[model samples]
Target: MKLLLTSAGVKNASIRTTLVDLLGKRIEECTALCVPTAAYAMSGGPGAAWRQISGRASTPMSDLGWKSLGVLELTALPSLDADLWVPLVQETDALLVGGGDALYLAHWMRESGLADLFPSLRDTVYLGVSGGSMAMAPQVGEEFVGWKPPAGGDAGLGVVDFAMFPHLDHPDLPENSMADAEQWAAALSVPGYALDDQTALTVVDGAVDVISEGNWRLFTP
Candidate 1:
């Protein structure tokens, strides 16, 4: 699987270039599925999902004009047959997942049977924004935990080995300052990254690279 994990969606030229490289095609040629399940657990969540699906959010996702775009609401997957949705996911060029509650997204991804399919999607791009990206980590850190899963803890899907701290130094989220990221990382058992809106981490074939047009930092524990 190819992962383009960003703090924000395609917010800058550098991140877009990395996305194109992962897709191996223009944005217009790819077919993407927008996963908005996580947003439902967020504040003003329905509105958040609508903005993401309608491409009206600050992020440049659904508005990128893919060949075709669809929504993959994870919450509703449990009631449907796998045959009904598995093929769609397998055929899509990318999964454009937006931000919200990390554990909530992780719970549904696991419960929806999507996380189980990750190993086979070698050619699929997983584009994650904020919570979307954090949900793939082994742990999101206690500070970011919101919608606690039944199993409990800040654990994620472990899709990637490291944890992530997004929106670093974001003016609107003063709590996400560098010092805050440091504190967050100090509690984790693995390495972690703090990325700004203009940065992203691309993972392909187990290799990871940072693609950024803004500041970022790596903290190792």
Candidate 2:
């Protein structure tokens, strides 16, 4: 599986280039599945989900011209049989995951059986923005915990061994400052990263690389 984890969705030219590189084809030639599951746990969730699905959000995701686009509502997957969605997921070119509550997304991914499919989706790209990106990390600090999961963890899935602090220094999120990120990383048991809106981390076949046009930092435990 390929991971392009971003603080914001393809927010700059560098990130866009990286995403295309991961796809190994033009965006218009690829099929994508948008995951709006995370948005529902946040404030103005329905509206947020609409914005993401309609490509009305500032992020450059759903609007990107794809050969086809479909919604993969993780919350509803469990109710349906795996035969209904599993085949579709394994065949998709990419997954565009929206941002909101990391733990919430992690919960559904596990409950919906999506997590189990990761090992099988070796050729697919997992494009994650904001909380969607954080959901891939081993943990998220207390500062980023909003919608708590049933298991009651202040974190996310163990998709990656490290943690991440996103939206660093964003004007709208004062709490996501570098200082806050430093403290958050200090408390974590694993290494972590503080990513600005322009930064991203790419992981393929266990090899990790950071690509950024703005700034980011990796802190060790």
Candidate 3:
């Protein structure tokens, strides 16, 4: 599967250009899934969150001539049926995960058995933004918002071996954000990428490439 991991939502025009260039040909053919809010939040009520996510992509996706599935429903653990969701995953040419609480999403992924299901979705192109990107990493560091870290070796889906630190250069963001990412990379003895809003890390068949309008850095532990 090809993984498109972005640090944030599509903000700059250039990044959007890169995205279009990368997927425009197949956009109209893919069944896009937007996991907007974390599953925990959805357990309460996910209507608002779903609307926010779908709305962001509706215009741009339409402009790109992409046929969005408009599947804005939440998948809870008790209600999760692989037969149901897996078909949605398999039928879709691509899956788009939106930004939110990484830990919350990770928790649900594990609970819904999606962590195991993902590897089998090898034919599906996985696109992630912010929390979405972080959810695919082996580790997401300690400062994640809204959820607690897992015990033992339960980091994330481990779809990729490296850790990801998104929103690397937001002006009002904390100074320690990047530092913590660097430190986490060192502590784990693995490679890490720090992405600005417009930057993205693309992984296909285990090959890693960077796509961005500005500079980014790679950290190896």
Q: Best candidate per lDDT, number? A: 1
Task: Give the worst 10-residue stretch by lDDT in candidate 1.
Answer: 57-66
lDDT of 3: 0.65
- Tens digits of per-residue lDDT for model 1, 106-216: 999999999999999999999999999999999999999889889888999999999999999999999999999999999999999999998999999889999999999
lDDT of 1 at 204: 90
Displacement of the residue 92 alpha carbon in candidate 3, Å? 0.5
Question: Candidate 1, 159: how far from true, in Å?
Answer: 0.8
Candidate 3 lDDT, 1-221, residue by residue in tens: 67878876555676565565555455666566666645335333355355435554422221334476644244463486557676676667666676666766777677766666677877666667777788888777665545665553437667788878777757767763667667656766457788887788778789988888865778887
Candidate 2 at residue 93, lDDT?
Answer: 98
Score every model by TM-score.
0.99, 0.98, 0.80
Q: Candidate 2, which ten residues in sequence have the lowest lDDT sum?
A: 148-157
Tens-place lDDT digits, model 2, residues 84-169: 99999999999999998899999999999999999989889999999899999888888888988777877678889888888899
List residue ranges in candidate 3 displaced over 4 A.
Answer: 12-24, 39-48, 57-65, 72-77, 149-154, 176-184
Residue 141 CA displacement from its true place in model 1, Å? 0.3
Candidate 1 clash pair list:
none
